[model samples]
Target: MGGGWIFAVIVVGLIVAALWAFTKGTPTGRQAGSGSGSSDEVAQLRKNLRVKALGNDALVNRLVQAERNRMPGASEAACYKAAIESWERDNR
Candidate 1:
């Protein structure tokens, strides 16, 4: 009976520890975009786009313009491409 109690306590402790580790160490932010690409690569791509266009405000405005110009049900990729094009046009 004592051994059983010891085992139960150990199991509970382990469960608590596992739960704490899982929750405490996990990232709490927007997930990275899907694909085989590393997060660093995706972040770098976003950074490059911003740098190429000057800043986030410009990028966002361009995205809004692209959304307005897009057909209904346009893919995100299409919108992003349009935003890049608009940014290039305006910045140039």
Candidate 2:
């Protein structure tokens, strides 16, 4: 009788774990209705864009400096993005 109870508990535990895994495998996971994505989405997008922009030219310090000078009120990130956009335009 004790062995039967133990077997039942193990089965229940396995079922719970399987359910948890299935839920996690979903596209949105636990945040189905949430408008915002995972916290890293913005950071990942920035990194990916930066990589694409710099694919042809690794040395863009001068361009970034020029962009910063053009937009004195802009933040460093804004200046960098502008420089990348300029680079993409000129290269193409």
Candidate of highest TM-score: 2
Candidate 2 residue lDDT tens string, 1-92:
99999999999999999988753433222223433334454343245345645653445556667876999986655555566567556766
Off by over 4 Å in 2: 1-58
Q: On a 0 to 1 TM-score scale, where does candidate 2 land against the true structure?
A: 0.39
What are the per-residue Cα lDDT tens digits for candidate 1 across 1-92? 89999999999999999877643332321134534335563354345456655687665656645665774565444444445556566776
| Local lDDT at 6 for model 2 | 100
Misplaced by over 4 Å in model 1 are: 1-45, 61-65
Q: Top lDDT: which candidate number?
A: 2
- Model 2 gets an lDDT of 0.57
